[model samples]
Target: MALLHKAHITPTKLELLAAWLPARPWYAGDGPLTRVAAARFDDPAGEVGVETLLVRAGEGPVLHVPVTYRGAPLDGAEEHLIGVTEHSVLGKRWVYDGTADPVYVSTLVEVIRTAGNEAVEEFEVDGGRVSREVDLKLTGSGAEVAPATEITGHRDGDPTVISTATVTLNVNRVPLIVVDPADKGVLSACWTGQETPAVLVHLR
Candidate 1:
């Protein structure tokens, strides 16, 4: 389960992404970005925040960006930092590109191999638990997967690939309108407004 607080955050996520997205070589948007949906993955240690955001800039294709927030800096990952922000409840948060975070990589691989279901998110407000709806639904292939000691992500094309020693994951950075059910060894999701499910990642 993912617990959410009703606290404020300085330099909102969109504000941060707006500044960071343009600098990426794969970004094709020239206008403002609007968030479509978001989902979270639980951190067993409860020390890091793992969330994926779906956003689109103007009329461009929807983009998937996963980010991890930590209380302290990640060692040897200075280049992946998406700048720090002050969390009203958690104090200062050091955000980094999820691809470089071990926690994110491990959780993603586990989800793919186990075909895990999405975790429930609840907002704690006034001592009451309010269930938060997840607009996107994700499912994996449930096949045996090889363990990866080293992982790297490439974002130069439409389908971004994250490669390891044994497996290569093709993540659709820009989601498609219709999903192909014939596609195998993949992770896919569908939003509330979309008619068909979009392929998020495929094992290659």
Candidate 2:
């Protein structure tokens, strides 16, 4: 389960993405971005928050952005750092590109290899717990894979490539809404305007 706080955050996520998106070579946007939906994957250790935001920049196509939130900086990931933000309840958080984060990579590997679903989210409101409705639903196709210990990530234009010695995951930064029948052993998503699952990542 993913615990979400109702507390405020300075320089909201959109603001941070807006600033970072323009610098990425694979990103295509000309104006302000609007949140379309979001998906979350739980970290087994519960120390990291892994989230993927689907946002549209003005009239542009929806973009896939996966980010990880941690209490401290991820060593040797200075280039992937999105920005540090102050969370009212969690104090300070270090945000980084999920592709470069080991926790995100591990959880994603678990999801794909186990044919798993996204996270169960709950919001702490008024000292009470309320289930947070997830607008996006993503599933992974099962595969036999070895656990990943090291994560190396790079971008091939639009797709972010996460690789280990035994496996390679290609994450589509700009996902298409259409589905392909032959795409197996992949992670797919189905959301509000998109009922048919779109291939989000291909593992090889």
Clashes of each: 0, 0
Please report the candidate that would top lDDT against the real structure.
2
- Mark the 10 consecutive residues where model 1 has the least summed lDDT: 147-156
Could you tell me the lDDT of residue 135 within candidate 2?
A: 96
Question: What is candidate 2's lDDT per residue for 1-204, written digit by digit as tens?
Answer: 888888899979999999988888888867889998897999878899999788989888888888999999999999999999999999999999898998888888889889999898998777889998899898988888887768754654578888887689888988866777666668898888888888888888
Q: Compare the candidates by TM-score and give the number of the best one.
A: 2
How well does candidate 2 score on lDDT at residue 191?
Answer: 82
TM-score of each: 0.90, 0.95
User: Could you give candidate 1's per-residue lDDT for residues 1-204 as a string of tens digits?
Assistant: 999888788888888888888877667765789998888888778888998788999988788888999999999889788888999999999988787787876677777778775679999878889998898787776757775556765443556667777778766777755666666667677787874777777777
RMSD of each: 2.0, 1.4
**Residue 59, model 2: Cα distance from true site in angstroms:** 0.7
Off by over 4 Å in 1: 147-157
The lDDT of model 2 is 0.86
| TM-score, cand. 2 vs. native | 0.95
